[model samples]
Target: MIQKLSNGFKEIMIETIDKLKSSDKRIALAKIAKTYGDGGQTAVAETFHVSRDTIRKGSYELESGFPITDAFQARGRKKVEKGHLPHLLEDIQAIVDGQSQTDPSFNTTQLYTRMTIQEVRDQLVLQKGYQDADLPTNQTLNTKLHQLGYHLKKVQKTKPVKKIEETDAIFENLHATHEAYQGESNAVRLSFDTKDRVKIGPFSRGGKSRVRVEAADHDFGQTFLSLFGILDMSNEHVELTFTASKVTADLIADQIEAYVHKLRSQQEVDTLIINADNGPENNSRRTQFMKRMIEFAATYDIKVILAYYPPYHSKYNPIERVWAVLEQHWNGALLNTQEMVLGFAESMTWKKKHPSVTLEENTYETGKKVEKNVMDQYEKMIDRAKGIGKWFVEIHPHQCKAALYMGLKTQ
Candidate 1:
């Protein structure tokens, strides 16, 4: 019977003969014999630049008829000392199971630190015969742990805020408005909001380095400020006005006026639709002021439409999104002083990646306090009316007109 050579087996036999002719045939034979078991043939051939058949032939010559035993003995690299494979495996299992009881997520470092070599040795002495056990070193344990798919990491739990009931309505309104603006040739809808009572300057410091250096020297003081901004949906222009007080309807009006004038300067039409939340300022006891604002807008043939998002749904506001971006930019990091805070705040500019409207800090004098009567009137109107228009029309009897006037002159 003729033995038909498998693919590349003849080439391997020729290569094995070449190795046998080398100065150290025994060493070469041992290497070739090692390759026969498992998937070692390809690896041995690549390592020694020989063929698989050459390795197979040399392996056959070395073992003769005791193929199974010879191949098993030649498998992998020889262990210089083989004292306790079973004991080491047990120790590792014990450590893993013990840690799993306390913290199922315990990583390799935690395991290693918690289970010392002496402790493991003691446990082996008690559970099994230590004389026959070969304890693994920390490095070996770490490698083994990794091989077992154990790794160190920080597990974090995320708690996202639940969507309020009003969010859907607000989002719906925003989408409708956005679609309407897209269809209109020249009409623009601007979303405006304020970051109220944001402390300016170095109100807080963060980071490990900052914490160490400014541990005792840091001065924590509050510098109240407001960021009033308008986002023009048409051209994506953002106009910001910074103030040093609580945001009120008057301030909102002032910003709107400035925005309108700027638009007019750019030859843009004055037909603007302003959207805001139903805050006290928006529905203050300023009927005359609101009326004037409306009449003034009418004079310019500009229709002022006020859109209010539902209660507890402020997050639905586009301006709220802007604030979120700003907050992310300034999150947890501290500014050393008011100047630093202002610089940092002013330094914030929008880009295509995180597209935002730019806000410039304009230091306006505060001390402007809204009267209790105005608030009371606003409360009454809000209480009597339902939905968005209730406050503007019912809260303060004549306040909407007054706000209009204030908005017009300011514009």
Candidate 2:
């Protein structure tokens, strides 16, 4: 009875296995064989730990013409046996280094388009004796080259510094004065500067360009004229005077005198404030003359105030803008003669209606020096009178008003 039962069981197992093979159910077979309970009781169960029924189902599915094992193994391409990456890297380096000295730089995309990937791959594999699977893409090669310091640029940014306390105070005082009397009818504020000994005729030759004009033949070496100019900020009036030598305190005094005369002649109230850079001439023996003039103006009820800009900051002077305008008119063209230069300077006019004084052929003398002792005394006097109304030897009413408005007590 036992032998008969074993034969029947064997037949059942064979039939099930055949059915699974035909159905192509290898995964199912593997799964069940991996989980079968008894040792060697089923053909696939001992080897793969699966149930006999599962194996029979898998075998039946396999026999149905399905190739599940082959399909699973074909998911990924086998890695090429050799690597061509190192050779590709070498090619990239060679191309980059060769182009470095050229006028324009070439990048990886351009190189890639010039050579096909297959050709590059073949070059690495055959010509360079590199393996196939080791080839790098164009992007990877570019990044690697950059890491090796092939191409790079840098960017920069800057910011303005904030105003300090002392400068802020100075600005505030100036602005307040500007707001109070800037547009007043009889009040005048003038910005003054001296362009001393600027060459009055053709000095330097035209540079580089071979084309020459006949005018270039007339060259006057190292001749200059001194220009003292004042721009009335309030009224847009300009006053300019030219001398044959360096400016002196006397020249400045004379210019101021002329301006005063013009103001009175026009029946305009002579309330004037002179603003100038901290030049020695602006604060010289002529300053004594200016002081006397200020006192004289006080008698006539005309006011005169003297103020100077800080050192090394002359570009803030309004007269510099006037010079820029004058320069633009000249446009680097040479002045053939003194008369021509003077005429061109005098012909410059402002867009706004304003009074202008231009004096030419004025005389100048050098070697007139202010003594160090006098300058020292003047500085001491100015310093001692810093906070008191009595500091100035002579101060006009409007000047006193300005000093007070600037938060300074009479010295």
Candidate 3:
């Protein structure tokens, strides 16, 4: 076969011979001997640029195959740290499980020590008395660590709020108010809250879009857009207002005022049930928010009922689900300017109705509050439910409206 081989075949074998090892090299020579039949070894050695004696040995071995026990025991590169580098695996585990044994945070099962592969290699050499040559490459170490169930992961927040004793009672009150509003034709239940603050400049948002856009390298405290939103549960209507100011009590009150006017213009809504979280701006105990709410009730001739969810339960709000939809809709687009942000928000549809977009360029000052003495006089109109007063409050139009209007008139 070697004598019959073309020059091209001989050249290809010469190029590949250096890459073959052990049994592979012998197998190539044995195949040539089988093809040649006689003087095959000499013909193969001369044609393929190999020693004649080496080819003869391979031919004899091919003719008389050895037993399984006579074959080589091991092949390939040896293990990196053969002699159990003395507590190396245990130390790696210790570093990977940092502070988790004593202090744990949120809903993550895996603890991260934030140690790199190079750091691990250095630690082994410096502390464990292991030579540099014995340590495997970083890639190999990473694979080994993964095999041992250690991985690099970010921390997640899953810890719930401290269990409230009156959680059931609060939920019941919320349900009763919802049902009451649902049954009344003159009532409007609006889920009132602010969405996550978005930075004005180019920033990365979650999700994929058809068009590719790049975000800023860092999210500095540049300009930001605050969304004060209200979702009417009765008609599934959404009202979103954009502001460049902090989400304060004044801002919340202003948003409520606009929402009230819009609803009254469309139909008769004598009662406004506002569902929201117990955030600082809209807290039941916030005197400023209470004062503004009473005036809001008086101006619109509508009774206001504030129903707050338990702490850390903001996800239960109906508007929260709408906000989630809006987030998903614009996640892929680049919101580099306020116009883009507003455009994306207006384009997103929830329940087949696009939200009414209003730009509130009104520069609202933070920390604006009514005097304690004046607020105390109007507090009489605010009625709180017994035992769970902080979670429920009712502001009657007849009670505080006169006092609030009088005060405003004097101002």
**For model 2, how does the per-residue alpha-carbon lDDT over 303-389 read when each residue is reduced to its tens digit?**
655555544557877898888777665545566677777777767776553335455565656445435544443333322113221
In model 2, which regions exceed 4 Å deviation? Answer: 1-165, 204-220, 284-300, 352-357, 360-394, 397-411
Question: On a 0 to 1 TM-score scale, where does candidate 1 land against the true structure?
Answer: 0.44
State each model's CA lDDT, in order.
0.54, 0.55, 0.78
**How many residue pairs clash (N, CA or C atoms closer than 3 angstroms) in each of the candidate models, in the order given?**
36, 41, 0
- Model 2's C-alpha root-mean-square deviation from the true structure amounts to 18.5
Question: Residue 241 of candidate 2: its Cα lDDT?
Answer: 80
- Highest lDDT: which candidate? 3
lDDT of 3 by residue, 1-411 (tens): 554559888688767875776556766786776787878777777766788766766666676784123245466655544445546677666655652322265354544545677877787677667788867678988876776566665566767667689888999999998876677989988898888788777777767877768887786857889998989888899998888878889888978887778677888989989899998888988878887888888778889999999876888989999889998998887788899999999999999989999888888777766776676687777899999999999988988766765654311
TM-score of 3: 0.61
| Preferred candidate (lDDT higher): 2 or 3 | 3
Candidates in descending TM-score order? 3, 2, 1
Q: Rank the candidates by lDDT, best first.
A: 3, 2, 1
2 versus 3: better TM-score goes to: 3
